[model samples]
Target chain A: MANDSDGIDIDYVANLARIALTDQEKERFSGQLGDVLKYIEKLNTVDVSGVEPTAHAFPLENVWREDAAEPGFPVETALKNAPAVRRNMIAVPKVVE
Target chain B: MSDPLYYRTASALSRELEAKKISSLELVRAVIERTRAVDGTVGAFISFDEDDALARARASDARREGGEALGPLDGIPVGIKDILAVEGQPLTCASRMLGDFVSPYDATAIGKLKAAGAIPWGRLNMDEFAMGSSTENSSVKTTANPWNTDCIPGGSSGGSAACVAAGEAPLTLGSDTGGSIRQPAALCGVVGMKPTYGLVSRYGLVAFASSLDQVGPFAHTVEDAAILLQAVAGYDRRDSTSYKTDIPDYRAALQENRGPWKLGIPSEYFGEGLDPEVEKAVRAAIDFYRKEGCEIVEVSLPHTEYAVGVYYIIATAEASSNLARYDGIRYTHRSSEATDAIDLYFRSRAEGFGEEVKRRVILGTYVLSSGYYDAYYLKAQKVRTLIRGDFLKAYNQVDALLTPTTPAPAFRKGEKTDDPLRMYLSDIYTIGANLAGIPGISIPCGFSGDGLPIGLQILGRPYQEADLFAIARRFEEAHDYHAKHPGL
Candidate 1:
């Protein structure tokens, strides 16, 4: 289920991504992403030892705001764009029997 | 003949509105007419509410008539890239996932624009989820380069740039993640700036790569861009990452901070793959500054070659995580064919996302997948550190770094769509600034042999946008490139 070609297992990765790719899309993406991965291997040439990872350009500590409740979106506004609304709540398919 | 009202810069329009020579309603009508006349070919707008725009314009006119105008941006109509939430406006990221979705609230940037008396006019198009370098990835429509309708307006801020270039709007807001704003602005021959990472709050901007994403402006001139930037910049509690520095008056700084400053030209950016015309124009610009008593120094970014590679890995990895919220449950397109919850996640994303978005998500998922994190994602982050270090080291010696915004001018539609690698390389020159988390501005430097516009990019230190704008304004004052508009 993994590492079929180009170091990316299409089925395994697609499953992880929660995407159901068509066969044609899988083929096209596999070849294209393979080229990108090959290009990305250039990162291997850099000596990154002792270099710190930069998650953001600037550093900041934990940002804390006053723990007070403020008015939020009303129920109708919150559900305005919901695909399925039931009794002012988003309704999803049944997950458990 | 005089230029049309739609083609005038916002600064000039502001003075006209103050003198009662033109009403905001008149200007809005002229812009609406221009959009109707040319957007058929440009495809810059996804949707615009004419009555809403007119009503806002009338309110602005009333404020002016009462001598209670807000500021420079009052009565000005700025186009909004669809990536930012404009309350009640369609918040499509040019993706089918949110095709019918309406914004529940205004983005912090939009709130500031409203407070400044600026009307957020229309929803501009972009690459789906702000993923591609070209607007061709937009599921709604491909925004053509207004300079030559056959070519792409470089994206994911293509519509923001195109509308200004097409004279449909005097100003626009665009999010830059890995050169989304600057690259398109380069292609379309307008002034676009990406402020320092935390300069403008990103509260309502749909996340692409959170670390790299920033909100900035597209306008006809550096002065106008400064005006627009002034309106939306400042700290907000909602966006904790936003900087808390004192906000400078960018427009006033343009005139006050004149300098024969030292500018750096990175040698790595001048090598192979750069179109000779772009290089020639950029070199000429360097020579222009040199003749104006500014010193030009050659610097090395060293890791420039790895930028595209580093960007793709990091940006897609973040995008994959940020976009996971679209699971057909809340405000996104739900699959009609789903039988179960998991099936809904799979089928809805499969059907809703465009081709490029799907490719990036799968690739991102693979890199962050178990056993591959250290090899791909972690390594990319380390390399990102080196890239940022390179810019910081260069800044220690020079006021700013100058380079070509893109390798070449705009390419014909469908040229690079087949090869994702080729398309990724289009942002090579502009990606470094984003990775470094610094401010970058793209101004029209020259035109290609084919009549396409070329951009000269200026990269400045983090939170030093005023100095950058001042430097850009100096170059702009000596050239008429910014004043030139595309003939539609």
Candidate 2:
């Protein structure tokens, strides 16, 4: 993978994603990420001015299910995989004063 | 009959069950025993619940004895890629992020499978979070190609393909975000399909990239794949993306003899980086179609080279958004050392994610960030439209397109892991279909000189999976590649 000197700051990207990477990962991924980005440079040259961006493969519009309330997962089942639980609710570290 | 029963196709097993010559319990036992015998080397399953599977099989046998058989998939032993929830089963997605998590409910596909009396038995291995091209990225299991333990069964559906190929399971469900199912199926010498994006419901499939992610099946025969597809395809209220159109009888479609179909050969797919042997095998398959009186026309998808780049931008952007929920908040692994929420988010994600996953997240976040969004993500989406238009335009002239499922057969383990770009290119030939929101199937066409299996890919218009499957069975019925198995 070439450096390409894309001037991209990987640490900033990692920060936005809230992932703490070791210094080793930062150095290695910087070059690897650059190579991946360089490949996308081909997209910059394509004339896509009038093209409509297709977000879904299908052209269908919004589909709504019956609004009637239905049975949902049981409380215990909902909380089963929670890393921290307090009285059947997910426990999170205090965020605000 | 001791072990040969394990190697039979689901169709054959169903026949024996219908004839009352064998019970579902007997079939389950044979497959479980085979798993125990060979899975240590194959590493095809993340978890196998032998007791529960046998109980389910016993119930299926009870139903059949009462003359209440369900459907084609009844009494079948199937492996499920860990990405889909199967109620009370471990839903790890072969990742550490969801460590110890057990699904509380079955996914829509699993619900349909259960309704058809399919005994979903094992948690098949996959690339962690379905992120890599090889199953080596799985934190819990290192799945190997049953064809040769030294080589990879292409992934992130490696375990699903390997299990079917190794005779451990007659059928398995695998999710393809970008050729995950088809690539591995090609490498393992089986059949794998990716239905039109909206054709199969993705409800309960752990999202890697929502738009590209679809649940399909891996089987030893194309007809069996059709059976599995029929059992699972339809409208689902749970999935907004699932198409509401009437479901067609795929097996009946196979019998329709919609032959002499016009096929397109994409010249771009055969250029540089294609293995010479793979090229020969795929071309020979095309020649076979030509001999069947099917018109083969040379077609061009000029923007094919930009697919991987455009795919990464959009797929990673969606993945970045979807994965944000795993910030050690409600469900999943949390960092034990964190004293605050912010610290926990960073440390937990950093520790739980594998290398490839982290790289994708970072790349995705960067592309969608404030200034780069227009330069990357949005631009990629526009390019995506062009890519889709490319397929639509080419489809106006042909009923289907034929190409190699992969650039080559499965490579040796650890061969391209360090080179991320090199690994991403492993899916080069198959990503165009996903980007275009169409359906594609991979069938074993021939073998590489070294004895590894090669695959032929057939792609069709959206919701035209039946056409793709019809042609697949046509070519499949004419060859013995689908019948050959690895010497496991």
User: What is the lDDT for B465 in model 1?
Assistant: 95
lDDT of 2 by residue, B1-488 (tens): 34388888888888889998988999999999999999999999999899889999999998998889997778888899999999999999888998799999899999999999999979999999999899989999798898889999999999999999999999999999999999999999999999999777899999989988999989988889999999999989888888889989888999995688999999999999999999999999999999999999999999999999988989899999999988998888899989798999999999899999999999999989887888888888888999998999999999999999999999999999999999999999889999998999999999998999999999998898889999999998889998888897
Q: Give RMSD (Å) of candidate 2 vs. truth.
A: 1.8
Worst 10 residues of 2 chain B by lDDT: B1-10
Consecutive 10-residue window with the lowest summed lDDT within model 2 chain A: A1-10
Which consecutive 10 residues in model 1 chain B have the weakest lDDT in total? B1-10
Residue B287 accuracy (lDDT) in model 2: 95
TM-score of chain B of each: 0.99, 0.99
What tier of docking accuracy does candidate 1 attain?
A: medium
* Quality class of the docking in candidate 2, CAPRI style: medium
Per residue, candidate 1 scores C-alpha lDDT tens digits across B372-414 of 8888889889999999999999999999999999999999999
Which candidate tops lDDT?
1
